[model samples]
Target: MALSLDTIGPDTKNTAKGRLEPAMPPENRLEMPTQSLGRWSASQERKPVVDRSRWRTYLARLFVFGGGLILTGYGTYEMYQVVSVSRTTVLQWLLVALFTVNFSWIAVAFTSALLGFFALLSQSRGRGPLPTTLSCRTAIVMPVYNEQTSRTYAALEAIHESVEATGLGAHFDYFILSDTTDPEAWIAEERAFLALRQRLGPQARFFYRHREKNHHRKAGNIADFVMRWGGHYEHMLVLDADSLMTGECIVRLAAAMEADPDAGIIQSLPLIINRNTLFARLQQFAARVTGPVIAMGLSVWMGRDGNYWGHNAIIRTRAFADQAGLPDLKGRPPFGGHILSHDFVEAALLRRAGWDVYMLADLDGSYEESPPSLIDLSARDRRWCQGNLQHMRVIGAKGLKLPTRQHFATGIMSYLASPFWLFQLIVGIALVLQTTYIRPEYFARDFRLYPIWPRFDPERALALFALTMGILLAPKIFGTLLMLLRGHERRASGGGIRVVLSSLIEIILSALLAPILMLIQSGSVFQILLGRDTGWQPQRRDDGSIPLRDIVRRHRWHTVLGLLSGISAFMIATSLFLWMSPTILGLLLAIPLSWLSGQLGAGLALKRLGLLRTPEEFRPPAIAIRANELQQRNATFGYDDQDGLLSLYCDPELRERHVEMLSPTSRRKRGEIETDRALAEAKLGDAETIEDVLAWLKPKERIAILKDPALLTRLVGLKSGTSAIKAAE
Candidate 1:
């Protein structure tokens, strides 16, 4: 596909004075052909071969995975002893198996944290210096779905300013690759694009393109750009809608790519920022405090075979176009279609093709936002769960390395662990119920010397529980200790005492929230396993407040289950009730806990008292502040406030720009009809006024009308009332 630079109007003689047409940057074409999953050339030559067998990588992997296995073995034996006071029943054996799986999961984390803690102490946590210049051009692209145009565009503007400040701005081009399906959002983006370009002037290399068909979602959006314009640049820095990075970081990343000819993708660790709601703040704190340790550990072991997290990463354009074309999995829906989690697969494919994929653990200035509420988080998690679960198919694709496969396995287990934990809990409860209520088989049919008793070694079980908790908390502990030891970090986070208090608060809150999330994820896993698909949806990105009735309605079942389980545990034994207290408490308070998750007041009150205060919150980054200011300024312009039809109806120049930017529609075949288009045409023909069309048109019909030039021309000719489409109902 050869995309041409679109210059809207060559003749501006009749134009209003001082008015300028929105001109897009000339397209630098590239061809990105899709690659096959089942076929690849093993003998293909590359500049640099990634040495997975390097001693450091080998030793790191050995320490992490090998240590996890050794710990799992010891933990399994202790669990067996706790359960096997006598002849082990099926339930006891199953419990031990579950224990082994769950134990190994944390054991890996514990081992990784140990390695990361030492690595951090020894290594400097900084990219040496920003490069003064770069010889190669890079495209900084952000793919937007049905997101708020103000926020997304504002972020781009801020990044643009930051990049220009580095004096390397000429080497970078910015593209807003929009996959927006929303009619209003589509126009709003165009309006913002024009206004933003005008503000930045003609010399700024900013462009916008909206896909007619949002095929394959985000991956397709990016692939479309790569196929059309990727060849212009040596590398592409992909950013999420919520992603923000400093000029130094962007320049450094491009320089790093220039320095390493074999580097395919270098992912940066993005810390969460600008969150005010309690759940978002909790996440922000946790990611700031402990996320680095975990990320550093993954970097140590992953080495050149690291994973891409979809955004905040720079990819070599040629390598991605050649090797990372994702193949659709066979079958249907969640598992059979286009890959949802394309980043990990892309990284693996690049590695399979002998390109080095890396994670720059020390890289900073990359940042992103978290979902503001539990419900919002769960909604996002559902899509992620389905995506990760889909990896089960691709893990076996030809030519993937063992570590790449391990990455796949780890992703799969991340979601699967929830179900495993839930099942283990249920089985543990069942064991207790049997012991308390069901009669035990005393004498065997063979006439055993003594009667068998259904019992666990209380002391050993308690010790095992302690060990499990220790392992689970090790990463957080290490993170806290590191913060306290570093004077700058300690002072930034409100001193050692406040840091300790905040960590404690985070630990307690996370403990309370874990059970709820476990149940949510477990349900998602079951749904995906049953062949259910989680469709794409735009995440809510503001203060995620919910109505009282909605909160109760959502969490009532959880509360009831918690109550029943608590009652049963108490009825079974005091020890059992005590053991299950955390889970029970979390589930029982699900409604209020969920409400608190979105409460800005609670989060702010804590902020005032210096609890959950991240270093970023104390010293706000200039880029973040500028983005927020631009967002507010953009909001005031009412670009996002107007409906698509009304915006076009009101502004003739915008309508012209919109029509010019639309990709030429293909000719329909004989007997072919677009359902939405047909419906939209019929409605447009019947409509007497713009008000009538706005009142009667469905969302799909609106989109269809917006896309059809003829229909939009008719919509433009409609009689209007004194007022346009109202922003409020």
Candidate 2:
């Protein structure tokens, strides 16, 4: 597993004329391993065997799932009995069906949480010792889109330093895989990378590669890395731009992968961190307290048939390449083309090939950031909604394990349940309107003991409602109690009283926010159904406060709808109005709610009051602290505001590095016009100075000029007062 530093060096060479030349062919210049490296050894192959332990796991899952189904059935029957006590009409039956579907969703979550709670209670708190040495070469890959260059490289540097501290640095290599589209971002990434390498010294095993075309976005970025350089490593630990992991966690994952030859992927549960906005902090706290129990429960039942979250996980590189080559779905965008949610599908494919996918839920020090605002979260969720819905096409694919299919179903339901709940609410309102305004059938074709009345048994309905609320709230109660019982966690989360109070505040806020999310998700589902695609967009990770006007513009419709609904409900019945108050209030206050969600002052106030405090917040981890420090240090002028053309014109070293990083352009067919290059060349010929060319060309045109060798050479010469026409020729 010893890594050789001989092959790792700067890719720039100086020619006799002092012009920079690419040291290697463009295909091999981006720090990729040579193609002569062998694939994973045969001994690493996973063998499928019928282990009796799988049966036990299945039985446990069956028991938990079966119990949930049974409970849901009884609840549905009780509701049906109450509805029938008045009158069983078509509308009533539809209400019953909607109620059953929506209730079942919660029922499954309740059961899963119940199992997770018990699992947490039974498990030992102590982490097992890590192996002193590792025998496999692992690559830590962080895939970046148009993300902040400083933050990404800073996080990587922190992780590298942490791993080196563990005294096993040579066995692992770090990669920053960039698929950035913006020319400014591309340049920024290269600058940051070179700086990071220099800071870490030449012996440090850090490499970077930028792709010309994004292809399938994040999934494609990783795939390109695998196809080109995956052969050199036994394992690859994939990470997102916002991901940060401790050295100990990284080492343990690698050691665990080496120890278990049959395992294909081992996922670590990543908690949210570095959040200051009220909404972000709330999400962070919930993930800290409730995420582990839920994750552990899934792990307990999933055993060998587990899921991958795409990042913060270690995987058997060969198994992934062999089994998880993603296919373009049948047709175009949205549900077709490239798979958006590739992680789940990859996990399923690995399991189909008999490779075990596991979740190490107990592993700590894995962290990620949340969206800074509710609006930002909605944007991210829209993409996720489309991705999850796209799973409908893959769920029935042949050879998938039953548990894998279940995982797919669970993901699909996560988005679908929002719309289902919205539909149920609409149906209930319609039924109430019909009962109040429309005439009910006094008699039916069938014989009846008495005339049918479209009225529900209030007492029975109240009891059923109470039961549903209890089940829905049980998980939070369980999580709270568990945290209280654990002395370390309890103290870390302020006192028990503060924890309970924070939980209560969180619950109230969640209740207020739930309806807003439901409406937003419903709209997203409708949009997706109508063939509107959500393209890949970078998430907003920093907690800068959102403008009030922007919040109002986004939520104006919600407020109007809330007013109308409240008026209608009150006109129908006082009981209906009272029942719908929570929803109405949330909707009516949507703008303010969203505005406050992104407010830093409010979040800080809560922090100062010792509310919503997580263990990480109270005592920050070393890796997190180091990452923050590096981020502050690495902050520089934003790429977008600076002139891309002038940047290269000013710095000779940067210009050379930029040229070395550009992928060699493909040869054009005869008579095929390079429109961008043609326009860029024309602009360069007309310009007298760098400022003239910068003013004449747009962002895309400028990027084109930089990418083309001839165009860039001409632009550089013109900046030095040379003849642009001769340089172009």
Candidate 3:
């Protein structure tokens, strides 16, 4: 047999392949690693595990982080206390009455706090009621193409098995909803769904549908499902390809829907729990632990008003259909295209129509696997940015209520949260210094020494500290108690010292990651707002280690921002740091923290020392038992070898390896055009349908290809349309 990496390729770490080319050039990419390709040495190919000596190994970061959390909790409490007191006792002699009035300051702070409070309440601990009788015959929808049906089906089957295990599987159905453009993958999905249907018998209803036209990508595929089979059920539960929620949670979502007929949507916080690479592992750990506090806080605050994330949520059919009609954009690509981020707007629409949208906080067993690497996460975010930005158009459209506007505003600002935080933190430092160093002012009610503007009276400081600590720590206490009250912590947290310690460790890591992420998300959000795009890229779905150069390439701007941020902090706030050592240290740590934000340094170091190795024990049992079957992912990519392979084509390990093995040079020679074209055509074979032919087009230029050669060829074959294909091959 020829050296064919066309199957899983040489970079066979996880199901989703990794890089097959040289590191992305700095000019073309941002927020990537430094030494990208060489990071994953041959010996490091495996999955992530809890560092047994995690303490021993990551000891330096652990103590630094644990100490940092204490400082954050303590300092934020103190800092906010200062702000609250100052806000209440307005300065007497002020140059600007606007500053004295604190109009915008109070407006934004209370607005954020108010919104935060609402968001907090929305993640309430209590379940409204469980369904005594299943009112809605549900269909849990999973869509996939040639990409990775096995992983998709596996997650679907796991969820199905989980539901069946509950004995309520009969009320629920499974749809392997596909917009797959590949014959092999689509055929595999058909066979798999049939097998699943057979295996489940009548315990569960299983259906598989693949659209001949995958017009709107995910949204289009889903709309097709609703248009066709939606009427059969009152509600539908949707899952992304990488999403896997345990059985009990799906049942709970259904039950919640049944219990509350007025509830238009109930979204489970689809947190990431398991991943293999260091980046994915860190994210997964953070989501599982910090997620509850943040989620519960938001849910408690949001109450019956919440935005819908695209998947891992249950939605009411009639309500969504009635209110959530999406109109195509007339503008340019990216934003003007179809509504990419449809979940939030649909939720907003549902609420506008007077239905409740709830986000359940501690809905146990709701889980998902993380994007296996940082590169994957960034790619997904790019698509989401485009989708969510499209909603900016819907914000001002008539008929949306105040709460609906709140949701939309929240959605738009969520991406900008990072940018906002970055600006606030920088300005906050400046304001802090001005207050201390600038000339003191006499306030209306003060006595002794004339205090600074918005005077940092110590009493005011204490109260803010207490209030903030309560807000931040309350969720942890609340989540722990609820689980303990439910008597499920042992199962939920993994029990004993290991679980408790893990939770603490997770919190610390999360804190370190936050500011860095704040920068990334800010850049991402603002870039979207500015119409500077991070395009639709697929995630890294495997356990391969990333090279340093890769990190530098992807995230150079981050490096630049971190270095600048740290330098500024040192320059302007040198005195304040000496006053508050911890805060100063935290501020100073921005450089290294930003550098290692993705745990890029740690991952590299781990691989070098054989510390970050993926353990076999962590591999899914399915992969071990069905090794041959698992590795037999003959899923063809929906790509054309024409135009020297688009970015994503070379992104996947399998395709990249195939290209390398097929031809050593990444670039194809001009004279070999006919030869390679023949090879590519041979691989395409006779595309079963014109749709398959189109899926392989330069995905970015999908619209431009309407007047394409292949389409003309098909039209010529039709003998009914004008235009002809010149190729006789």
Candidate 4:
């Protein structure tokens, strides 16, 4: 388990006994140039056998889109008949347009789920046998931000151990790429890195790098890795901080890549796991039960032109470096600058270069965690909404494939749908108010045989409503039936009866949560359209309840709006009130529902009742089990709980090691007037003791000092007064 310090640590030529050593692996450089978005040339590699797949893809697309069009047309005609009974009005046309948009959205999904249903019935999970050995090396890179060191490092350790167990560990190496802006989190990452190395032994290929500046966020962190050290490996399997995969799955992905030389990216469908909150468990259940069907449909129809979900996907290093380099768009935040949703763009670029991108839906063992609560989900969705809206600028880029463009449209619509739904509701409400209260215009400028009435045939309206509900709910039914029909899947999801019951519970909960999320997403879209940006924030992984006041503050307006909508609907008609009850009740319960979404006790109660039980909960994966065990052991270090500057000042060894790890730099450029660094230098010069420096330094100043060896040394020279912060204390 031991190795010479010379290979992985700082130079020890003049080192004292008490000095700490650097905990970094040796450098292996690779050049990955930023790609040009304006022009692209297809790769000259041998293409895969795709004649049959091409036909299948065309049929699938035609079936889904054509069927959707047919459904939309029928629904539109029915609405036209209902409204054009006497004469059509402006409000009626608006209603029809909104209805068409909303109906088409679900119609497409309904048709696709039908495709998925049939595909599932006949699809095979067999991928033959795993390759005996690998011909190329892969770098499993996990890009991290300001994250909990213990949880991330523990997950990494588990993944590494799982890979090693397969005896193909020699072909793989792991890297922890950090873009942490938090100084304490940065140091904690280093400490955890060292601990992991010691535990895994020198035979394990583990590396760590922390960026001084988080320029492009995660995309930048990974780009830094690719530019610096990507050449040594044939493929890079990207992992998020919460991602974990089995050794078998890892090897199989590598094998798939090796087998398909045309493949640029191979994405594994990662299911949700290790979640406890009511919201999270609901997500976990839906993903485990229904995700596979949807993914299978996507994979089948998408063929080799599939999209990436950022992480838990393996990419050809050469292909990605050559074609997938992202460019900042023109303009400002929200719609401009560096691409926020880089995964879709990267896939498009790769496909544009004539490389295949595939999503392996049947590949089990890829796992990721979800945001634990409604508030947490809303926070994450805001960022996604902003990112997806930015894709509008990329959709028309030259040389992009049709499917690639469709992917962009789909992403953009996912966020925009919320606002569209809200607008549709408003339009419907306006129509209802006009019918109930507004004076009808009996006279027209032009000669008319009959006067228009702002009313719909109740029978036709009711029939259309039934059809819309069927289209909307078909996918869930398809997924549930598919699960029930399969003995293994049915058993894995609890018994058939329990599975049905759980599906119903998830459906009901989702219905209640939909209106709330709709409002949240609608607001996000509005803000983005107004040129407001949503900055990246770390997701809350634990099932921690938000403050009651915060929940009330967030949902108060939604509650009031719901009440008003209900009152108006009831006044309009009893039928209207009944029709709108789901939406009204959902918005009315937003605050309390949000509160319960994060409650551990409520989620556990459901679990005890055998509801929302994922197969992973029934038979936990070995890697997941190992990860939990290591998380407990690693968390005992409590590195994140310490103050970075104070810990270094009190512990000389850590200070020395911190200095040794900084990239060798000359003096600051003469013309440069960096505010933070300059301020840090001035404060350190004036400080007489450690406490003075601690009190004087801002976060930016602290980061500047932490990155500069000279400033660190100056801080180390400060006096340790009685009031000085100490690591022991």
Question: How do all models score by TM-score?
Answer: 0.95, 0.92, 0.61, 0.94
RMSD of each: 4.7, 6.5, 15.9, 4.4
Candidate 2 matches the true fold with a TM-score of 0.92
C-alpha local distance difference test of each model:
0.86, 0.81, 0.52, 0.84
Q: Better model by TM-score, 2 or 4?
A: 4
Give the poorly placed runs of model 4, Cα more than 4 Å off: 1-33, 40-53, 664-667, 722-729
TM-score of 3: 0.61
Best first by lDDT, ranked = 1, 4, 2, 3
Clash pairs detected, candidate 1 = none
Best by lDDT: 1
Clash pairs, candidate 4, are 30-228
lDDT of 1 by residue, 175-243 (tens): 999899888888888878877776676678788888888899999999989887887889999999999
Which candidate should be chosen as best, given TM-score against the real structure?
Answer: 1
Candidate 1 stretches with Cα past 4 Å from truth are: 1-26, 45-53, 666-672, 723-729
Output the TM-score of candidate 1. 0.95
- CA lDDT of 333 in candidate 4? 92
The 10 consecutive residues of candidate 1 with the worst lDDT sum are 1-10
Question: Candidate 3, which segments miss by more than 4 Å at Cα?
Answer: 1-136, 165-171, 180-205, 246-261, 269-271, 276-286, 293-306, 333-335, 359-363, 373-375, 382-390, 428-500, 564-573, 576-729
Task: Sort the candidates on TM-score, descending order.
Answer: 1, 4, 2, 3
